[model samples]
Target: MIEPTMELGGPTGPKHRPGTLQNVVFAVRGQAAELAFRDAVQG
Candidate 1:
């Protein structure tokens, strides 16, 4: 799931403009951070 998205982000061509790919990356990273934070807090 995440691997494809990251791979797609490898090339910052015209299609992967500033906000487009960056937003997806940020969303994925944010979800990961939230999950990690939840785990840490639970622990």
Candidate 2:
């Protein structure tokens, strides 16, 4: 149940920008990887 969430600077600002979306994807992937590593270590 590890769900990664991204806040793209709220509604009405920069959320629809291509670069912003790319950044959000990268950020989410990084966070998910970090969480997975932690879970593997703990388990």
Candidate 3:
């Protein structure tokens, strides 16, 4: 996910541009972080 998103160079080509793909990346990472945190806490 991060690989492809980073490969696009982002939505604006060069400049900083927000897009749904970026959102998906953020959500995926966020969910992963949350799950890891929960596992750590429970363990």
Candidate 4:
């Protein structure tokens, strides 16, 4: 299977990209886990 590439320039005047939903969720979860671990270690 072939993947699509972002157009350098077009009628829309380039695409505005953002992080994937899964990545955003993972980042939040990871930060929460890190904070919990730190709290456990300190307290």
Candidate 2 residue-wise lDDT at 3? 34
Worst 10 residues of 4 by lDDT: 2-11
lDDT of 4 by residue, 1-43 (tens): 3211112222222234344565456556656666787799999
Query: Candidates' TM-scores?
Result: 0.55, 0.53, 0.54, 0.56
C-alpha lDDT of candidate 4 relative to the true structure? 0.47
lDDT measured at residue 5 in model 3 versus the true structure, 0 to 100 = 38
Worst 10 residues of 2 by lDDT: 4-13
lDDT of 4 at 6: 15
Better of 2 and 3 by TM-score: 3
- RMSD, one per candidate, in order: 5.7, 5.4, 7.1, 12.6
When sorted by lDDT, best at the front, the candidate numbers are: 1, 2, 3, 4
Name the TM-score of candidate 2. Answer: 0.53
Candidate 2, residues 1-43, lDDT tens digits: the string is: 6333334333433456756767666666767787788899999
Clashing pairs in 4: none
Per lDDT, the best of the predicted structures is 1
Give the clashing residue pairs of candidate 1, or none: none
Cα lDDT of model 3 by residue, 2-36, tens digit? 54434344344334445557666665676677678
Residue 31 of model 3 has an lDDT of 65
- The alpha-carbon lDDT assigned to residue 29 of candidate 4 equals 67
